[model samples]
Target: MDTSPYLQSRQRLVPAPPRAVFELLADPAMHPVIDGSGTVRAARGGSPDRLRLGAEFGMDMRLGVPYRISNTVVEFEDGRTIAWRHFSGHRWRYELEPVDGGTLVRETWDASRLKHKWALRVLGFTRTTPGNMERTLERLAAQFDGGATPS
Candidate 1:
């Protein structure tokens, strides 16, 4: 219903096709660019194949001054939706849709619990995380040959 205040940001992009875009979303290796934090190394529960409901993994997230968590894939549907809820009390989701010409990737984040309030407050408006997210999307639309396939 009312999912603002807790809402982080959402952006849509038409990049490549659903297959190519889904390939990136299905893998965690290509997340650091969009997530702006972690370098996924050896997914705990499942790795590349963990793109479905209840798929969980421990992402060594280096975020907001060294933040990490083991996240569980809460919601998943091939080429449609992928969501994760962190054990630490926050979550995020991404919705993908194959438009007539290309794929649309929409992303959102929940920061109600304040993942890094102190660090965020200190930064004072120059949030690199969100900036990275936006930049990553733009880059993908600009450079989505659909060859890398998200590790």
Candidate 2:
């Protein structure tokens, strides 16, 4: 985990291989299915189905109000890691580590570059991010383990 105070992370050992997990992470269309916060609605048009470093994707979101986020893939390591950033300047990252016949997935929300970091905290994001991340991992695991789809 990052030592920076502006970063929060959650992890889980999922019964899936790194390649499998990475495929989901690299696909923008799959994001809403694994999102924990329920804010992600769908992948908007013009976004790539599979993302790579420097690729851009748009998502429809609703958090009290409907909105759209255009995100750029800023980091990529094939089956190991991927990260993206939006207009907020914050980043969402996923790291995969092979362990004990499964993959240890670590998701991080880094707001260190945000111009108004305090505003996010004031909005309760700081309080809810960790739990949301945990749920995201659970949803991801279930997607590969036979479970209900996001509705």
Candidate 3:
């Protein structure tokens, strides 16, 4: 189990190049196609075609009730890393590294900067997010691996 109080991450070896993986991550329109949690519905209007540092975008989402959220890209490193945060100050980050045969992708849910870290834990985010991230990565990898459906 992770000892970190405010962050959870999962990694997978994806059989794709860093640029290919980064392209998918940088496009908000593709989020729902790859989302494992099933909360993301679609990208809102006016979002940039490609995300960069300081860019803002909105997503239509639903956990139980439909809602919308806005996010800003807080970190970017071309094909290597990207991270975004919404109003709550937590971030969703992806880092890619070129390995021997493919890219090693790491997805992280970072709540280290949130004010109510304990609240998320109490709400079971800490317990549930890792599995969600793992599935997200699986879906991402599937996009490059002969179109295998991600379960």
Who wins the TM-score comparison?
Answer: 3
What's the CA RMSD for each of the models? 4.7, 1.8, 1.2
Q: Candidate 3, residues 24-67: lDDT per residue as tens digits?
A: 99999999988988899999999999999999999999989999
Query: Clash number for model 3?
Result: 0
lDDT tens string, model 1, 67-87?
456777888777788888888
Q: What tens digits encode model 2's per-residue C-alpha lDDT throughout 8-82?
A: 988998888999999998988999989999999999999998999999999999999999999999999999999
Clashes of each: 0, 0, 0
lDDT of 1 at 107: 71
Taking all chains together, each candidate's TM-score versus the true structure is 0.68, 0.93, 0.95
Runs with alpha carbons beyond 4 Å of true place in candidate 1: 1-5, 37-48, 63-67, 113-129, 142-151
Show model 3 residue runs off by greater than 4 Å. Answer: none
Candidate 2 backbone collisions, by pair: none
TM-score-better candidate, 1 vs 3? 3
TM-score-based ranking: 3, 2, 1
Using alpha carbons, what is the TM-score of model 2? 0.93
Question: Cα miss at 145, model 3 (Å)?
Answer: 0.2
